[model samples]
Target: MHHTARKFSLSVTAILASLLVTLSPHTFAAVGSLDLTTSGIGYFSLVLFVIAYLLVMGEELLHLRKSKPVLVAAGIIWMLLGWVYTQEGMPHEAEHAFRHTLLEFAELMLFLLVAMTYINAMDERNVFDALRAWMIRKGFNYKTLFWLTGFLAFFISPIADNLTTALLMCAVIMKVGGEDKKFINICCINVVVAANAGGAFSPFGDITTLMVWQAGIIPFQDFFALFIPSLVNFGVPAVIMSFFIENKKPDALDEAVEMKRGAMRILALFLLTIVTAVSCHTFLHLPPVLGMMTGLGYLQFFGFFLRKTLPGSLARKRAIAESRGDQAALRRLGDVVPFDVFSKIARSEWDTLLFFYGVVMCVGGLGFMGYLALMSEVLYTGMGATVTNIILGVVSAVIDNIPVMFAVLTMQPDMSTGDWLLITLTAGVGGSMLSIGSAAGVALMGQARGMYTFIGHLKWAPVIALGYAASIAVHLWINADLFVK
Candidate 1:
């Protein structure tokens, strides 16, 4: 199935590439440099933005040929090259600047690769399944468990990431929560909302925050000043969502019999992966991807250890062996691995990752188009830095926040400590506005299905919008004069 998907993707890419080549010179040459003073850069920007979004959406929504989107990327690149030339047009004095862009792009590519590998490796170890079962065993009744899972996804995402955290929580929800789909939906929504919200206030959380911090648009550690506001954004909705849920009592717990203590030991492995990645980023100034790849390399050693000793699995087996009544036929199914598990985990929603890559690269291409450069100069330079921060937050809610954050990072405006805090608050929490507004929100829909549907999220849009306002208000109230001088 994966190979088939790959083939289809390639085929689609070919068709898109052909169309771009045929359409390129005319469409792109005519585009020239867009002037916001006229029909507005927003128009051209929207065109570029929608095309990129269509490629992603088409890839997800339609089952076409293999490598289909790869071709689309080529055509878009053709358009981008023309726009880049017309807009930025080199330094004019024959200077070499491509090196810098490529360097930045490489770092991002690495980050994506490492993140993917780490997630796959962790799943191979069944770490997430263990975590969910433990939660169920702890007697966290439905409501508490619901909130607890989301809160964990929230905090863990800052370190683990929104996609990885959401995917992991989904497995647990599927296993213990039964076939009632709404449970999956609700759990997913809360998890994503919390994840992005928690991620907003931390430099370590979310790729977008890292991009902004790395560019020095915001100082490290100052992001937490937005924490109170960030909490308001997440806390308000979570409270509202809770009011709608039917709370039920938890099953009683027996004695504190541990689920293999060794499962906890894997936390050390997880830490090692993170530490390795961070060190590479800090010490060598390498892209986060290299670190993730290095961690993937380390997980191979972990696999050897797993083969040597199965911890929780062995005990669970022994107890099954001890049971006398209906042992024979049931034991076979229980002990043997289900093919469904293989397909589910193997077919984990990976297109989302590729979609992210395309969206970012296109956004980078749009940045090449110069209107963004103009925005920095006119809007940012004229309005003063604080309003720029607010505009950026609003922009993120309407567009893919990642690129907006990236553009803000690339521009590298001189901002007050308080102003920087506002960027953190909005870019992180602002994405809750539409389902596609944030990665966590988007992934939750795919991972959990009906619960976090776009309309469902849209229903809460007004509330999240209010939360967005409240969060900014909190930031201004708390950090007001730091904005002044």
Candidate 2:
């Protein structure tokens, strides 16, 4: 399957490349005036985008990485656009557009890199393990565990991200539920829903919200404005799902996993990093990425201290003496590896990050070609902004929200602040309507495997759709001031 997918992708790229070469002169001349909507290149760009996106959507079945087709498509589209600028004898214009795309991609990647590093550092410290151990030790009833995991996913996702939070919460559910497949399945759904919803209200939560915040379409304070609506989104489904859970208590584990040294300290530092990032963005007139990187520096310093200073501290001396086996104790300490940021970066979601790059360029190419203008007119003007934004969420469920949100951002539709918030809310939570919709849902599918399949999530789609609609309605009512304009 993988080999066949690779061959298919290469063939597509080659065909697209040949077409670009054949149409190079005409394409470049057509884009000279920045009005390609009537040109052949414009329609061609749209076709390429759709094909690339479809390949991305069928990633699982194709056994192809989502990044491959889109990356190739992005390059081809931009190359074609660049050709247009070249033929127009305005090469600088193409450079400018490419530079703009690169800049945006850099800002987003840096921000994600720092955030992911902090998350990886925390994982290295066994922070999640500590929480999981506590839950298992508590031996909570199924209903209690259900709600607890759901709410935790809701709140923690705003900081840790929805995909990671869902996976962590799923681990807890799997641990507690043991062989109860039904219990695990429902809780997984609830966690995916709650995590995605929770992520909607915070800039750090979902990629869509972050993009909106970073693009300056919405103020940082306005992100909190959706908190209530996001809560409603999660709470409604959680309440409905709670009644479906059995009340029996889970079995306690025979042993608990001990947390690594500096686990609590690392967690505290992670919180401080969040504060630093927010403060920098709110007052320092700096990008949130700067503050996050600053915080990462702090962690690196502390990691060095742990790797160098702590082992030789008086506390270690006392423990060494007590053990009467310095070599053995030293060996144990040696087993505790320091937080290596580079390794974290290597392990981070490279595919997702690369996909963002492709999506940005592809959308930028479309915008330059004026496809976005047409989309804005159709969706915002024809369908009405409210309905269009709501529909965007539904589209997000079918495809990844990252590209959907990017395309919307590129379009820069003329809408009120409330409309922007509506799109943000829908894009983030709408993915919960289907198992493959959001990263959180898709990830849980792999994590829980046979226990929580697409069919299982589909069974609960209506309940999730209810939450999706109710949350939008709630946002419309409570935050109506945003729509006043």
Candidate 3:
């Protein structure tokens, strides 16, 4: 099934490329050197983009990877734009724009790769498993665990991505809640809300915020101004739902787990890496990825140290086992183990990286064709920034926030810093309104399966909506000075 889908995507992309090539010269110069936005090719490009996004939205039902269709769409869209630019004697314009978008994706991809490697390394060393075991051993009642998990998700997501934070918290929910579906369902909702809300205030917290930060529209420290509003967004929904959780204790099993050697060091290295990335961007004025790549070197050297010492450590253990005449222990020590940093890199999320590539290129292509300018005129200029930004938050609840945020950035509307921050907060937290809205919410649905279904999340939409509105109101009131300038 997967192979067939791959072939279909490739075939569609090839057909589109060929069709563009075969179009009459008249179609290329339809308006006699007019703007591409009003030309025949522009309309065709829009149709192609719409079809590609429809496929992206239907990924769950279609049983196809979301990246495949968008990858194909991006290629075809750019190919057509390239042809038009070449015909107009401005090929460099197209080439430069394409390269610029690729650069953006490159920085994002490398930054995420280093972060994911550290996360994978920590996971492999039983760091997360140990944390899970500790929580379970606490044997807290359902209500206490509910608040505890929710608050943890809220705080942890600012450091880790919201998706990862949600997955970890969900694991605790499933383990502790056991067969009590109600406890599991409500807790999952709280995690999603808290994670999304927590991510809104930090550039590292969400992809949308990262983009805004990279674009130089907002400074790093200014993001913290949203901290109060973000808390309100998460706390409102959590306080309302806390009443629904039954006061009961889950059955506990005693399981003691220890983190493998170097787990703590790797975690510390990750924190240092984040600081390096921020410092490089803020002080050195270098691309943050440069610092991230440097941090990757730190891991590589530490991994080498662990590998170099393994045999000596294993030999000493084997010697002790032999003296005790414990044959099983001696045999187990015979297998030497070493940490390999490359393995962690290899385990990073390639699908997500590629999806980002497609989104950036496809949106760049549309912006080049003048669609985004038209959108800016209608949405930002016509509707005004404040109203348009609020509507965008609601729209994000239906569509994925990545594309919506990307398209807005491409528009480059003239708005105040407060407006920029408002959009950032909305785009990040708005996904909490629907299970399918944000990556964290979608992942939790899969992790929790039947207990956290779309309908189940939808039933609480009104309550979540309340938090959403409350957040916006608080932002407008508390940060009123930002808008004045």
Candidate 4:
């Protein structure tokens, strides 16, 4: 399946490349580059983008990595655009636009890299595993675990990211759910909603919010304003789903799992890193990536400390275990390994990071070609800010929010800070309405597989839609003051 998909992707790229080369010079002459948005090249570029995105959307079924299609599309789109500009005697414009887009991608890439590394480090240190084990040992009833996992997803996502939060909480649900498909379905839906909602109110939560923050559209502290609306979004669907959970408890497990040494310290360092990033951005007027990179340094040094102490730590643990005659302790101690920061960095989500690069560049290329201007005039100008922003949220459910938000940022629409926040909130939480809408949802579907399918999620879509609409209303009402110029 993988090889077939790769061959298919290469074939598509070759065909598109051939078409672009054959058509470019003639198309440029006919359209004359005066209005690239409606030019032959513009239409061709749009078609190429659509083809790329269609491949991206079909990633699950096609067994192809989402990054492949878009990366190829980006290269082809830019190559055509650059060729047109050179013919028009304006090569510098294309150069400047491409460089600007690259710069934007670089900042976002580095920021996400640091964040993913921290998440990977904590995973290595058994932080998430410990949390999972604790939840399983508690043996909470289905209803209690339902709300517990949902609430944890909400709060944790603002810091840990919705995708990771959902995956972790879904693990707990799958363990406790056993053979109950009903329980798995409802709980998975709840986690997706809660994780997305939680992320809506924090800059660190979702990529959309992070983009809004990095673009200077909203201040970091101002994001907390969405907390109530975000809570309402999760709460509405959760209340509806709670009654569906059976009032039974899973059998308890006696497994005792312990975190590796330095887990707590690594967790603390992550928090400190977040603080450092926020401070540098807020107080020092520096890019937040600078602070995040610095935080990576902290982890590196701490990892060095752990590596240096591992031999002695192991010796002491062996001595204590031998004295106490605890074979289990000695056996566990044997499993202890040196913590390598570089290994954690390597394990970060390279696919997602690379996908971001593709989306950024592709959207950036379209914006450079004038699609964003056309879009802005039609969406924000023709429809009004409030209606347009709300529509954007719905749009996010089908198309990934990263490109949608990137296009919006590139368009640089004129609107109040409140309107900006509205778009940010909508884009962040809107993906909850569908099973494939958000990363959290898509991930949970995979994690819970046969038990939690798209059809199962669709059954609850109306309920999720209610929460989506309610969230918008709550945002408009609660943040009314910001909307007033």
Candidate 5:
């Protein structure tokens, strides 16, 4: 703890330096602020991301207390970088810049909110809450239940974020594994990896993918190209983990039907939310979040109506009913509606939001320094080849892929179908490297403590590592013709 205040001051200094560059756009030697064509801003932003990642990892590694000042200071660094550098006294575009930043944060928040909402909503139905009870009744041995639970998480994550998916699956996992800490840790590890890898391909699967789609970095159709590779992403990890996971027998199902009319109600709402989200994007040109917000609003309205229309006892009974309905199931979905769950979802450790804000502002800051814009021009000119573009896309996963993709998308270079596919695949799966690599992975660790330990994760990184590497190989090989052309 020596010179603790000094360390904080030093962190603040980096932000100020970045902010100064952002605020003074004219100072950029290249055209506009931060050389988009060729300069240091992108790399500088990478530096910031790394520092932030390290600090976060340190806190997690050491089990530090909640440090608001640390978070606040970091956020300031990111904000100033954008407000000062990117906007650069360009009063006319200030609104656009601010709006874009908000949109970015909202996109991040939307993922968390939706995941939280769905999981809590599911819990409300007494859905996953019955894992232990169901497992007990099944009479399956611990070993058999462990593998079954992992498989369940693996498949569920395509719809659920890895964290929520992992959490949902973990209820069964922990119950089956009992007090075997090592087995429990491995099971959680498998869930996290599967959920994250599964989430890589679809726009709705992961926030980064959603950002890419919504920002038009990759069109909707282009996203599905990762489908084959995403399977590999999940499959590879499952296979490796399976090698470690000895197979067990199946558990029996007991008659514990809490099914009521509310299950149908929940299903209806889930479908409605999905329908509205797609419709808004397809017809209204609304971003996913706006549509989700609309759906959430409607859910609330529906709840109010139910409270009024349904008589007291009948409503209570149905609301408490368990079922095969979606997590958005009304009545039993306690986790989503309860005040605490809602708050937790809304406030789910949004350091990354601030991190994104920092990246946006920091990238803008480089423009002020004549660093980013120039670099952009250079990259666009140099990496015009399809192969090169794919290479860059793969590299993007190592750092925050958002800025690179944004920069590339803005350049609006002539790229082909396959090259764009490569971008989607690489950027999507690249985050499997470390826990801090992806938002969902990080959130899963916090949400499921003891179950999915960070060190335990490092133990099994090879599973996902092979997945990531092999998927890229598959992407390259499958699209060989396009790359060659």
Candidate 6:
């Protein structure tokens, strides 16, 4: 079934590509050389982008990878720009645009790559499982567990990605809920909301916040200003939902799981890497990616040490065969384990990374084409700034916040620091309102499968909606000073 759907999607893409190429060559000219704001081509580019976006949003139904259409659209948009530049007899503009895109892509990609590598390495060492085991051993009641998982999701997501945090917490939910479907459903929503809300206050929390930080639009310290608001975002819904959770205790695990051989070490190293990244960004006045790459280096060195000391089965077997004395086993161990960094990298979420690639390029192409300027006019100028930003946040619940925030950044509307923070807050937490709104929410749905579906999440949308409004109101009321010129 999926195969057939993919084939159809490809066919559609091929048709679109053909249409793009078949367009009149004279449509762009060397004399005037069309810009993105040019009526026909600009509108066409926007339509193409919108179509690609819709396809991305319907990825599940279409059985298509969201990256495919966006990748195609990015290529077409750039080609259109290239044609315009070529016609204008000034191809340097296109070249410059390419350079700019490459610069941004490189930094963001490397940052994500290192972060993902650490996550993969931790997973390889069963770090998450060990944490889960510890949690289960506590044997907290369902109500306590619910609050615990939600609060953990909120606080932890600021450091770890929200999607991963959501999945981890959802595991706890399922383990505690057992066969109780309704309990599992509500807990999943709480986890999603907590994760999204928690992610709003830190630059490292959400992709949108990361973008804002990397863009130098918001200082790292300013992001912390959203903390109270984010807490309110999580708190409002949490308080309302708490009444429904029954005070049933969870079953205690019969056996506690031990951490893997180097799991604790790896976990410690991961924390160090985060600190290094933060220090570099805060003190060194460098891009955080630099710090992340440095962290990756630390992991590599530790991995090498582990390979020598903790070789895998094949090495141990080889050592056993060569062992004349007890020490012979240790000496021959270096050949087998091999410090598997490549494996960790290979296991990292390439799909999500590539999806990010397509998004950045598609949005960048739109910016190059002048659509963002129109967007600025329509969104910010036509409507009041605060209302527009708030609406965008709500829109982010349905559409991905990554692109919405990217578009706003590209438009570069003049607003106070507070306004930037507001947009960041909204974009970050807005996805909690819908299962499909945020990566964390969507991920929890999949992680919990039949027990926690989209419709199930929507049932609690009213509570989450209250959270959505409350968080914004708190931000407006408390953070109003920042918004003043």
Say which candidate scores most in lDDT.
Answer: 4
lDDT by residue (129-163, candidate 2, tens digit) is 77878888888899999999999999998877787
Measured on C-alpha atoms, candidate 3 has an lDDT of 0.77
Which tens-of-lDDT digit does each residue in 1-485 have in candidate 1?
A: 12333222222222211111111111111122433323444455557566656655565557653134533653465454554445665332111223334455555544444444444444434555556567767776678878887778777766666556666666556555665666666666677677778777765566566665554345445666767877787787788778766676546444222233234445566577767766765678654446656765665565556655554555666577667454653554355432121232244334543444454444444454454566678867899887777777777766766656656655555677677667767777777777777755665566556545887777777867877787788778988876874
**On residues 311-424, what C-alpha lDDT tens digit does candidate 4 reach at each position?**
999999899999999999999988888888776555544555566667667777777777777788999999998999999999999887766776777777788888988998
**The candidate that achieves the highest TM-score relative to the unseen native structure:** 4
Going through the candidates in the order shown, the clash numbers are 18, 1, 0, 0, 44, 2
In candidate 1 the C-alpha lDDT for residue 450 amounts to: 59
Which stretch of 10 consecutive residues in model 2 shows the poorest summed lDDT?
17-26
Tens-place lDDT per residue, model 5, 206-286, is 544554555544555556667777778767777667656655543454535353325446546755775677677667766
* lDDT (0 to 1) per candidate: 0.57, 0.76, 0.77, 0.78, 0.53, 0.74
Candidates in order: C-alpha RMSD to true structure? 8.2, 7.0, 7.1, 6.9, 9.0, 7.7
Query: What local lDDT does model 6 show for residue 348?
Result: 46
What is the TM-score of each predicted model, taking all chains together?
0.70, 0.89, 0.89, 0.92, 0.68, 0.86
Find the 10 residues in a row with the least total lDDT in model 1.
20-29
* Candidate 1 Cα RMSD after full superposition onto the native fold (Å): 8.2
Ranking by TM-score: 4, 3, 2, 6, 1, 5
lDDT of 6 by residue, 200-249 (tens): 88866777777777666676788999999999999999999999999888
Worst 10 residues of 6 by lDDT: 21-30
TM-score of candidate 5 relative to the true fold: 0.68
Alpha carbon RMSD to native, model 3 = 7.1
